[model samples]
Target: MSLDTAALVTKLTEILGPSGIIAETAAMGAYLNEPRKRFHVPALAVVLPKSVAEVQALARFAFENGTPLIPQGGNTGLVGAQVPLKGNEVIVSLARLNGLREINADAGHMTVEAGMILEEAHKIAEAEGAMFPLWIASQGSARIGGVLSSNAGGVNVLAYGNARELCLGVEAVLADGRLYNGLNALKKDNTGYDLKDLLIGAEGTLGIITAATLKLFPLPAGYETAIVNLSSPEKALELFYAMRERAGTRLNAFELVPWIGLDIQTRHGMLDKDPTAGPSPWYALVEVSQPKGAEGGLLQAGLEAAFEANLIDNAVVAESLADRTRMWAFREQMSECQSREGASIKHDVSVPIAAIPRLIAEGSAAAQALVAGIRPVPFGHMGDGNIHFNFSPPVGADDKAFMAGAEPMHDAVYEVVLKLGGSVSAEHGIGQLKTELLKRVKDPVALEMMRAIKQALDPKDILNPGKMLS
Candidate 1:
């Protein structure tokens, strides 16, 4: 009882009206094209649902018609989770669902519809004299549903945690079209099973997140920012410990960037000026939040102590807001600057904080051994133990040939990551890109439990088919 394309489009258009449904391939390009541009499978139709009722109706129709439905938010996901896999699936774009449901500035919470942009949420919070600390590079385009779906972690994860931690509760539409009304402002609940947590990082395989109640925080009075020059990752770690002891919860961010990153960025003319303290083997960008009624300079003080201890060779503390912004732009532009070089093999992995030095040192050596002259650029959240371990091909190397050898490069780095008791995919979840890798690396018992849950929840294997689980 498979419905033809015309019939399916007609039915969806009737349910959502003409403006809500798109069937032309050209019109559906935006939804199909993901951020990474790696996944290019075209979807059968793209459905723009304007309300929760519309989402439920679309879900119900797909459930009855056996049409695979891919839930898409801002299309900013790094992995291929928000794009089509089977090519015949329908994409349910949540862009029209944007709205600020409520905001309680004093209570430290805001309830927002899933389609709202992450940057918009920040502006709303800031207007109320509060802050939403999840600051990803994609925040300009990433939406709430996709952010919560991927459980995105950014620079401030060392302070506020990931999307899952910032969310108090969520409201999602189940595979069978039932709305799970779980949104709440409560700080404590003895509720059953914690279903909200289950759905937060499920990657839309279990349900479609419609809205979420997110926790807010008092706006910091100001920030103390610095870029310190270090000899190595080990020294960065030592400086990190000293800063943590000094600032404690106020230590907002600690990011590591290699010297080559600075070189590439400068060479590409991406930065108007250097954001670091001259040249060094490594640099750690640190920030400390100053609460209202508190003084700044905590970060500067910590850097001074690190310099006195000989943990850091040189440092530059941001003297103005522009300086701070430039420093952050340099750190956030790490991924974008790679494209200017050429083909890059990337892995988002994490080990324990104490083992970060070894992880970077050994991982770099292994990658160099595999591909001679491979520019190893291991950098990211050193405080959270996560690193965007990436390698740019040698100068004047073939981009296609270098990418073709990615599998061997991936294997080499992953083996080292495994030996260090780290995770293969840290912040980014196992999308279609890592389904097989997840199956192989994940524990057998854990895999069985996941499959059992998938079967119990989405019995028809229609919700985001061939994603997260095989």
Candidate 2:
């Protein structure tokens, strides 16, 4: 436990071999850097474990030596969960553990190693005539481990559910290097407790997840995508409920986007053309999936009903694959487009589906009141109520000054969200950035139970220290 820096690196190198160990700070840039570029503390070392056994060994070593180990995947997490918090922590990278263990398309499940890229998992499932429907922006670089660990919620969460719901079971290495092989694809099990759910969203605080059994769905025949023009969030909510009543699970995504987002993207040349039907106050990018041999045009039918009821102003249903891609491009490029304007204050908060309108309205009003003209760009999965309530700086405003008001902006939005019975950290885990906020907002008994669980699972506090629960 008292080993010096050289001795620590040498010990890790011996366990993982030289090529697997990143001993120097300069070479650890990829693992050190995160999506938001927020937390930048240097690590003692970065150890890449090639196999589950190697992961167990590394965990055992870190546990016995009392070395703070940060469990990292693709390092694509927006929060600081996948990166280091304390300078003395060593990053245990699962990059080398990339492998697909098993696939059973007939049973609607597949077992994949933690290090497998989410996009690759998608491709693998597609090759077998199935689909893993968790579609996040970072799927290209985000690995399975980090996706499950962070309990990622993406566009398709309205239907297929989040990473936790898509996941059947997890195979992990506990703090004491005990391999908990609970990977199963069963639909029903009256087990003692749901440990898979626990470790999946623990953000590596409970254990180091090595592999997982993920649920798969039959490939949809086609996806009907439409960008509907909305006058306000209230209309969008009404439209969402109507679609849900009609399509039910086929209604996959209901995303809300502000017209200013379109203006920002068009002004910045990020898009070739405006993807919406035309300019409106707000837009809802609604999509429904048609399964094989099932009826098509469900989304069209629903939209026609909405039109009859005078819900939306105008809309554009994607006619071809290219149109679909372009429509999605407009929605996916929201976060990037905001950066093109200036500094942006973002909150991944959620409200009740009914309360979404109030959350955006009051949150925007409160933000503008705190700092005049702070453009509110609240958008995301409206079906599930998780909105990325973000604010862009006004034209020609100072970035530093806008960011200086970030705390109050966050306070304002979270106040609205909490008042409406919503989660402050909707999809993103409480990493180093929101640890204090979680401490403040979370119930004391829940906090105590979480602390007790963390103590029971990771007694040494070596697994992802200073993350989630701090």
Candidate 3:
């Protein structure tokens, strides 16, 4: 039998005291409003658990009473993973659990609670003369738990890796309030099943991550940054190959941005000044990290080789820190600038590195064929094959009507992505938004295994019910 709403709130209050519960619907705006503003279902109550013991107690209550629980972090996710899917679930906000547990900079690892903001983690690492290189646009608001749950891949993923690779181990709360203490800093352990890997990208469907041990690296001496002009994605791919061959692991980032991004940002007065080498069809923000006691001419030499090979036409290298920051500001502001234009249909998809040119070409053509004059703004981490394929509605078009026809647009783009052997959801995991899509595209046996794992870990389905597997 389902628990009564009032009774559920009362039990939650008992477990966390009155201050830990937010029963009023009006005051739960921040928890309900995700980054995308897509999901709007009301939750039973928003509970702020201050520590692991509180989380375990709440989990036990949910399991016993058959109450659905949603584990939420900073609420900065693009997909609807961090928000409510059904109306009866209670939101468990982990903000109060933010704390640094331990740090061993020389050992190249640190243990931190999941509620810690990603930027705060970076600060802690820097204080010890080490670095945690995972960086995203929302790092200031995105928490470590959500970051690992989604297996977030950011701009620096080319050099370091995603959340899964950056994480060494995790400590999570199971469905029956059992604590799974998997936290460790070992570099190599050929033990039994890799529970750490299983939980890192599970999207909170299996367990609620309470704490994690993250990998750290030596701090770089400095960085070389530049923006190179290209004719198309084809030429950009060629330039990427040459740079990879030359810089190898030092090539920290190679991001592709279309001319539309530059046009949109400058038109909206988002940039203080233009940070490009005049106008071009496309631009790439290339960066190389210089390690301690190392020279810093790697990027310049690579760009020079590209010019010699006829892969690039024009380029502007950053001469100072301010120049580099302005260059990055242009790339980081891509998503916001699109909103300023109008309603846009977005897809976070990835193809093989070599197939990116074809994916962009075919995907753009497919979307344009469906909707006349629709503006295509496809750009992202070219080095990693993830292109944030997006489309702004045609100028002077009705926003609501354009959004109403989003289904067909999504189909058109996804078809091209799958044909090129690409993923429908790349860095962004399938939350409530893509459960149906996952059903259609994912392999049958793989889905079976995933469901089996979910059932084994959370048979009662009280932890993040109706998510991922649907």
Candidate 4:
């Protein structure tokens, strides 16, 4: 069943003009190389469709010829979802499909084509005096299609929610080249089935998302950001509870970072100055939003309560926008700072909010037992319970050897995560990287249902074959 590469290229060239196709292996480097650099398989060709009709034609050809199609966005995904699983598959990049379909800031919703860069969307919302609250480290390059497809949950999940929650509907091209027009700005709809939810977070297995109507919120007057010094994660959790109690819906972000993060950032000169008030074992980046025409100081009031309760001893509350930006820069640089340290084994996981402390404690201990002196840097959205549990190899340890032991490290962490009623893949969806793990840990009936839906939607298995359910 070998694919006729030459014939396939000819057909693709006909469907999309020469300008829209990248058949050369050298030219496909950007599409093949993912952020993690873990997946190296090359795609047959990279096809850039400018319109939804072009996407439909591409899907039709893929479906008719039994050729696998991997839909890609900004190529910023950590998991290998936006890249090729097999060398024979063709990558259908949505970069050219990016366009603003419609927008209504007053209605708190806007419809935009899938290829729209996330940062561009933010700009569009800001121009209308509205806000698209999904903020991620890669938002500068990540597109709406990949963001919604992966159901990205960034720092603001505490307030505005993730990509799926932020999106009202999506317009996608099905496997058979049929366009499923589900785009809408409706706040409430008694839909027969949540097709939007299914397509979203599906990692391109169910369909190729072309456009999405995203939910927007009124712009906040200001943000109160702070970095609180804490002795341990337990104290951070207590402080998070206090902040939430005080700010409620206004509490935008609650991120936890260990001392290692600051140390690495400082060592690498990633920060101009320390963002925390003073040295501590852990620091919590807390942010509360101030509504338009409302009195401020909710965060300061909450911090005062925390200080009175002895939950936190020292804290640095941002006095100006520069201070706030610096504080956020520290939190945003957590993942990048790890790369400077050394080879790191990372897990994007979530547990019951109450079980976060134990997850970190036991998970760190387990890793140390396996690799002596492994630096544990478990930090992330503490308010929502998703911790980017990561570890840097011991000082002077072999980077290759450290990565060789990644499997055992993953097993150890996932064991703890599952036992504590947590999801192994939290914000990052189950791309090719986690498909096998999903099979092992996912409930039997749930897996069956997922397979059934995938079968119904993609009967020929041409849409992102060997991903997610595979």
lDDT of 1 by residue, 365-419 (tens): 9988988999999999998999999999999999999999999999999998999
Residue 107 of model 4, lDDT score:
88
Candidate 1: 10-residue stretch with minimal lDDT: 295-304
lDDT of 4 by residue, 99-118 (tens): 99899999899999999999
Q: After best superposition, candidate 1 residue 109: deviation in angstroms?
A: 0.5
Clashing pairs in model 4, backbone N/Cα/C closer than 3 A: none
lDDT agreement with native, every candidate: 0.92, 0.91, 0.93, 0.93
**Local lDDT at 374 for model 1:** 90
lDDT of 3 by residue, 1-470 (tens): 26688888888999999999999999999999998889999988999999999999999998998988888888988878888887888998889999999999999999999899999999999999999999999999889999999999999989998999999999999999999999999989898999999998888888999999999999998999999999999999999999999999999999999999999998899999899999999999999999999988999999998999899999999999999999999999999999999898999999999999999999999989988999999999999999999999999999999999899999999999999999999999998989999999999999999999999989999888877889
| Count of residue pairs whose backbone atoms collide, per candidate | 0, 0, 0, 0
Mind giving the per-residue lDDT tens digits that candidate 2 earns over 330-397? 99999999999889999999888999989988999999899887788989899899999999988789
Deviating ranges (above 4 Å) for candidate 1: none
Using all chains and alpha carbons, the TM-scores for the candidates as numbered come to 0.99, 0.99, 0.99, 0.99
Write down the TM-score for model 4: 0.99
Q: List the residue pairs that clash in candidate 3.
A: none
Return model 3's CA RMSD, one decimal: 0.8
Angstrom error of the Cα, residue 143, model 3: value is 0.6
Q: Count backbone overlaps in model 3.
A: 0
